[model samples]
Target: MRRNPLGRTGIEVSEFCLGTMTFGSQTPEDEAHAQMDRALEAGINFLDCAEMYPVNPVRAETVGLSEEIVGTWVARAGRRDAWVVATKHSGEGMRHVRGGAPITPDTIPVAVEGSLRRLKIDCIDLYQFHWPNRGSYHFRKNWRYDPSGQDRVETLAHMEDTLGALAREVERGTIRAFGLSNETAWGTAQWLRVAEAAGGPRAASIQNEYSLLARMADTDLAELCVNEDVGFLPFSPLAAGLLTGKYQGGAIPPGSRRSHVENLGGRITPRVFGAVAACHEVAGRFGLDPVQMALAWAARRPFVASAIFGATRLAQLEHALGAAEVVLSDELLAALDEVHRAHPMPY
Candidate 1:
């Protein structure tokens, strides 16, 4: 696997990051362990997790179970030093985590302590804030998102506090780098501004939902990321398995995401089906697996440092990892671009 520098963090991670959001929910601990072993064997050193994960169903009881599973594997295999481990501190609205407390300088330490205790690691390679406290437009909520009401003073104050906490963690060796998730371009710029002025940690990356079906990152976000050297860690590069053509023609598999959430959180509209079918057609023309084609395309994006994807089964992980070696031709890339242009923002 080719490695890329994760922004200015001086940390090199694999082009493909193994996402562990399904560790305890769709995937059991044994399967998660096997998947980790297989990923490591495939030369994938970037492991991304969170404080509130295993979140397909996202129940109160199952929160943080994914981290525990990864912790067990890290403790048993003793490969903690071999891989770059990234995890997140949950923001408010998830009652199961820190009693739905808002992320602040005080709570930042508490969250880091909890994650360290669970993962049994001395330092998190990348400690990301899982969504902004002010609110985010991610997860299919861009339609109604209103950032106009955001208070700049309060938001910057919070950023300064959290950055101070992260600076302390960096000094204490509890975390090495910092990043963000579900953040807008403006929000990321503000963070960078505060970090530079206060001499705090700059966000090394931003994890968002980006795929052939979701091209929101192609505009301002891409420009900001490139100019600022903020690496892009795109989650759901497969669009929750929609681009793989497994759920084509409205045939939902028994254990698929569609079976749980009928539309996979507003991702399964009529327009989405057409976009997915177009991708499948392109894959056929190129004699490529749709899953591999999508993953490969995502990896080759300009500002994308790493693409994060989770697998519920060993076969799924193997199929996704196979894309690491599959190179897309110019014809395929052009065809994908055409499809993206036609069906941009399908959801």
Candidate 2:
């Protein structure tokens, strides 16, 4: 439960952040509350959520239910001061929210109000743009990602306008920090430049899919985070449960993420299971639980400020919590590197 600085925001959060994407869907309210309690007791202070969550089967009716559930917990727990809450504003392509509109300056205020009302909080500790208006390469979209058609002028203008609106929110005491999600190194650099020029809040963190299997952030993104003082918050650090060894040998447990979303957001591929097997072997050689080893590896990355992970059950949360104490040795780290070299980009 080591604490790391949240960019230059002067807020320190636990290295392990509790993710609430399954708050109302895969997990019920009472169970969600119990998970939160367990995470807090284990010294986790950061809670990550989103405006459109409970995402196993994201629906229009349950768009904001996750925030409402967290709000109820905050209301009853009466210890909001102890938690560093983070949530996101969905970007374009989500038809259920804002009529599937892109995140523009005009939409910032409305989105902030909706999130605040649902979270029952006057201010969000870290407010992130869920995805860029210009799409991202995350969720296994890198193979088809094309940024060549992007208009730089229009993109810069949009960044400035949105940053201005976020500045207004800062002045209004509605948000303390700003961040990005599913963004690239170039995108993050543009955001930093725009924020500097506009005198708005600098990007504090970047939440992207990062794990042993997904090492796209290991180069340019890692450099950007280190040099720019931006915290790297890795989402799906377990590779969407692939690293937990539960989906190996073609076994899809009942009610698991695979059962709901067959491919686990396009992460499933013919080669991924083989890679998972290699990682599992490394974990066994090191005498570590595969789940804890995967999480610990992500948390131990040099640029990572926090590794976000979610659980539908309390036992899963407890198992993940053990990662806080499982430190990978140099030998094991080298073995993992060898495995990565052999099976890089499994999906």
Per-residue CA lDDT of model 1 for 73-110, tens digit only, reads 98999888988999999988978888888898998889
User: How well does model 2 score by local distance difference test?
Assistant: 0.94
Could you tell me the lDDT of residue 203 within candidate 1? 96
| Runs of candidate 1 exceeding 4 Å displacement | none
Candidate 2, residues 215-298: lDDT per residue as tens digits?
Answer: 999978999999999999999999999998889887889989999998888888899999999999999988989999999999
lDDT of 1: 0.91
lDDT of 1 at 265: 85
Q: Could you tell me the lDDT of residue 283 within candidate 1?
A: 92
CA error at residue 265 for candidate 2, angstroms: 1.4
Query: Candidate 2: where is the Cα deviation over 4 Å?
Result: none
Give the TM-score (vs. native) of candidate 2: 0.99
